[model samples]
Target: MNYRQEVEALQPQLIEDIKALCAINSVYDANTVAENRPFGKGCRKALDAMLALGRADGFVTHDVDGYAGDIEIGDGEEGICILGHLDVVPVQAENWQSPPFVPEIREGKLYGRGTSDDKGPLLAAYHAAKLFYRKHPDCRKKIRVIFGCNEERGSSCVRYYFEKMPACRMGFTPDAEFPVIYGEKGTCSIVVRGNYRGGKLLALHGGTVANVVPQQCSAELLGEPAEYEESLNKFLTAHPEIRAELKGQQTHTCLVMYGQAAHASTPHLGVNAVAAMAAYLEKVCPGPISALIHRKLTDYTGAQLGIQAEGQLGALTMNLGIAKYDGCKLELTLDLRIPHEVEADALAEAVRMQVAEYGAVLEYQAGRALILDRESKLIQVLDAAYREIEPEGGEPQAIGGGTYAKAATNCAAFGPAFPEEDTHIHDSNEYISLTSLEKATAIYYRAIEMLMAD
Candidate 1:
């Protein structure tokens, strides 16, 4: 069918669809939540836009009460699903060069909030399905492209959809890197809350979401501004990866630190502002909160808490994603990606024991990890399609980022982000290369065709 040629012919329409979806700020908003719009108005709008596009292309579309939607092609009792999300993380507008919601193309890259993460890749997969259906009208298997609205905060959208609907026999989500993703690490989020007494730390705040490494943290302390500024400068001189600023009066001062932001799944790629701030505060406060921060939470490996594990898939990583300290109480939101070999309950217990010494309690939620056999039909088919295009591509690999694949059965994360390219999924100025998007469309088209062939 010459899938690459068909994709090239439809590239313009595919890019326009991606831009239309990316224009909506789909971050979940409880304030704007309504009956069908469980996530928010923006997410609902994104879902509707995708469905409308499907209908325009003469495909059967279904909206699952705004939590999720799907476009179906062909006819069959069982179908193959292409799962993707429309929701994106909150953005710091000041950090971006261009408006985050407004899609822009510069140096052959599309820049926007969800461009690299899922929106662009989702549209690419959707268009690939459309092209396949156009070329093969008598295909045996059906193709269902599922658009989810709550993948950023949690996969509540798909959870609701699956409760009302049944899972597909097999599928792939265009949310991760190329080649293929045969294994994904287990994911867990832990919140530690406690009260502390007798410390110079009065109030501290950082981070916007649990999946992103915080870029900035600000703390109010009971100290002279000049003294704090001197101490901060000394600290920066020793550890120059972060930047610090001091403000306010002599008696009470606010200290702000800036660090690099990356996905929580790969905390080593980022310099966490919360961790850096806590390190500095430990020297000044000498309290339980500071001690916990400096001792257990600062390291990305969770070595001090004795929860580190290296399995066949990968090592267990940790990110102190969010931290806030009010006058008397402190709360920390931690994101951990664990390998399948480790037990989530045991890891939580280890962390809980460490935090108990500081009079803190831990709340943990664990997510399932996807581990598929390398010789399975789904992985073999997707991997064959990928290698067909790039003969030198590596074998299917594992990842730490959680996707809708974990929410659905017999599904895995495939393509959109290539091996050598960094799409900046959860960071400022996220973008996707035009060439890569087109190539991914071709790969998805081939995969869908191969799966549906009689």
Candidate 2:
């Protein structure tokens, strides 16, 4: 059968596998972490589910101490690896129309936390591998589908897995947009902390992860409740997109504001709750903390911090993701996506100097960038496969998002996410279009066939 026919035959099984994997609330939880399950019980459960599927499909599956697992097919000295992750970020149940973990199909879109971000794409690639092997059992190279449990927090799971095993000769990860991604910006995370003098600002909290823009923030301010309520009403009137609520008594008032969430790589699409709350507090809480927020944290880019740069990989983007002030102490986490042309340490020092001006301590952690030659054999093959299916598709491009391509050798992000569709990755109501999933499966099958062909 042709590639499309094969994918059509496997669509039901693929959808079932994707749904089964998406049903697990695989967010990393340290509280349930154990010997083999380093990430948590939920993540361990997700890993086992994938391996179980592989075993039932008559493929050799191995779980690398719960940190990662792989399903292997074929036999040869050289191998091809397709890396993906099963762990998802924490979700606000109230924000989603449907339960985040319960996979649902509506209007031809599969809605769930992992459906668009990863689980859907992972299964698509797996089914492609299965189809290729079934048609060509004597293919010369082995195919390995590697799944990790800690990609959301960090790639420690894959790091440990790679250290234990040898690198594949060639591979691609279906975690980003299609055509193909040849360059990915460097990632830097900064934690800013300082003493907070309790005044109008008694307590503040916002955000869940550093890579996602915070959609909600709450603050307790020292002020007359009625006056604060009036001010909040005015703020809401001016900015209808942000919803605010006021509570508490006469002397102290609590405020909550809701904004839109998006991935840090594309912060312009999000309305950061941390920034919005800080903007409001700048007027009521006149202090160093508020000053820092107004001066450097409000913008999506690092222009105010004097660290912004633009290059082939794109402009440096920043997300003021998490913020908290507990009456006397304050902490803010910043996620920055840096272009390949910029120096990460130099940028970090500049950010450190900027935050230091406000008496805040800065700690930086950097993830190295990945850049592959567009003319390389791997890129050529993947690009050809995509163009074969999508005749008018654009050429391979750069991205700000980091993927397992950096963790694996000779790899780049090839996709299940189409340029025309918004997958809402790392955001609320995340879903994958069924058409995109099918096309991606066929592309993966074609790419694998071309790569393995002599």
Candidate 3:
């Protein structure tokens, strides 16, 4: 059945709801943790807002102890699930032309921090399920739209959810690129820390999380701002691609570098500010942390670290997501997307040994990769639903992104992001096109109808 008209009819409310939800700075805040508010007050508010939306529409909703929440439609025991996250990555507000939390529409696209990440897609799934049951009251099929508050960090919210609730029959997460995703790169975060003493650098900081390329990095060095001005100008002139400036403090000079931010899965698209700052530091200050970062982090991939690998899915990638050096201690967080062909253990050992050369200690946390057969029932049904709408769409593909699908069984990342469209998720000026919003809503509606049929 055609759902274009029904999906379009919901656009006005959908936009308003998107604005309301995206307005909350749902970035995980450790400072605001409490009993019922785990991720933070922001995420807690987003979760409550979503659950309230479900309840207002007459659906049964569960709080799942504030780590996550779900809205249940229909009274059936067996059903399909839709997994999504309400928590978003941290944003560098100065990079945005419009306030990151204040969503606005410009030229037919909704722009906000979470507009294209998972919030927009999550609502699309919600509206689709709402539309489905509204159009078919007698339908016994169930749809549970799960919202998690810890996806950007580690998805502990959904992990806590399944501990309290049972997994559904089959499901999909509308948090990735279009057509369908049957394979995703395994993800891991490696943090290295060490001591740095008697260096020109006093303090260095960059990036927010281990999943996004840092957009801005600032370092305070032991010198006059005027002392570094000529050298900084010379450096910027020699390296025209890098954008940086020196800020003066009484006894120290602060070197700030600005780079483009992109999701860690696609680090090549962004210029890592930390790496750029390290390059400059290696020349002027020449400390262990700066030298190591300059030597190791210049490449987006892990070729310098010798952990790069290629498999059926794709080549491995690494993002120097977070870096900090406070007078005495140095820390760096690297986010790596590994292919199945490479052993994660071996890669970790290699990185650990490399970092040890610089007198640093390494800690690694590994996650599982997802790989499903192309002919599986879930893939077949989802592909059919997608093909029903766009006959010329691409086949099921693999991505470097880690989605909620990995946290559940019999699930994969599905549409919300069209292949040709770059929503600039996890970056400044992130937006979701009006056409994509309506199209994704209709696609979810069709997928739900088809999944419920069988």
Candidate 4:
């Protein structure tokens, strides 16, 4: 089958679907909760519209409560599943020339929330399913398009659905980079909480989400702030890009630090405001928190803490996304992506030791990380589909972004993120080019077709 040709024919329709989804303000809003479903009314409404769209196309769609749902195409027997999420990261309209939610097209790129992270890929998968059904009306394997709504916050949506649905033989999540992902590092969120012992710092704050590298930090301090003002000023001069301030003309002031925000998965690519605050704070106010920064927060490349954790998949890294310390107490949350081969308990022990010095406690949870064998049919088939477009001959690599692939049987992250091309997913001005979208649809079509066969 000329899947690429079929994908080309559906390009206009694909773009229309993405625009329609993006226009719905589908970001997870907390206020839209009357029933405890986290994402607000608009996001839920957008999800419902997506399910409705699938049903309108003559497919059997199922809504697993309001958390997530799936659209089944083709009849009987297990087949390949195409997993994608409906939830999107919050948008900042001020950063873009056009509104972030409105999804404007300038210079051939679709600008909006979920365009690159998910909605674009979701539409591409839907068209691939549609093309599959159209081309092989009597196909043997059934195809399912899973729609998850709480992927960004937590995958509670899909977790609930999996409890009541049939298992997919193999699948791919179109939520990450292309050339496909062979391994996804283990994800663990560690938060250290303790008392500060002193009574000077008050109401420390930074970061909106645990997964986003905070671009700003603020802490209210007491006592002779002027004593440290000179040193703080020197520190600020060295890092001119950031905004640091000791608010007001009085000794009681709030120190604020600013940096560029980006996702925790790839921390090296972002400017972590939280880490900077801790680094300078450690030097200015030498203590457990600063020690934590030197040992853990400062290294996104995982070069320190004697945890240069690496494997055939990739090296582990930490993103100090959120921090709070009032001279009397402190709390730090770190997002870690570890190789599958590494033991979670062992790593947790290492972290436990670090926080133990200050009587601080650590809390951790393991997010799923699937490593599809390179020799497996699933990887081989997926590789063929990607090679058809980019013939650079690079093997599928590992990633830190968590996806639905780890939710069930044999699956890996495929497409939406082309190799070596960073569109800055989970950051401001997130977008997917028209060319990339088309290539993704073509790849998904071929992959779905090939993997569904006996």
lDDT of 4 by residue, 49-106 (tens): 8888988988888887677888888888868888888887765465566777778788
**Local accuracy by lDDT, each model:** 0.89, 0.89, 0.89, 0.79
Q: Give the per-residue lDDT digits (tens) of candidate 1, residues 1-454.
A: 3667778999998888889999999998889999999998999899889999889878799999999999987787556899999999988887898999999999999999999888999999988887887888777678888989999888999999999887878999999998899999999899999988666888989999999999999999897888776677889998999988888886899888999889999999999999898889877667788789889898889898989899978999999989988888889999999999899999999999999998999999998888999999899999999999988999899999899988898898998888888888789999999999989999998888877763
lDDT of 1: 0.89
Over 1-454, each residue of candidate 3 has an lDDT whose tens digit, in order, gives 3578989999899999999999999998999999999888999999999999999998899999899999999977757999999999988788798999999999999999899898998898888988998888888777888999999888899999999998868999999988899999998889989998997899999998988889999998898898788878988898776798888876898889988889999999998999989888888879788878988766877989887788988989999999988888888999999898888788889988888888898899899889988899889888988888888989999999999988998998998888788888989999999998998898898888888888
Backbone clashes in each candidate structure, one number apiece? 0, 0, 0, 6
Alpha carbon lDDT at 64, candidate 3: 94
List the lowest-lDDT window of 10 residues for candidate 3: 292-301
- For every candidate in turn, the CA RMSD to the true structure comes to 1.4, 1.2, 1.3, 2.7
Task: Please say which candidate is ahead in TM-score: 1 or 2.
Answer: 2
Worst 10 residues of 2 by lDDT: 223-232
Candidate 1: regions farther than 4 A off: none
The weakest ten consecutive residues by lDDT in model 1 span 445-454
Residue 73 in model 1: lDDT:
77
lDDT of 2: 0.89
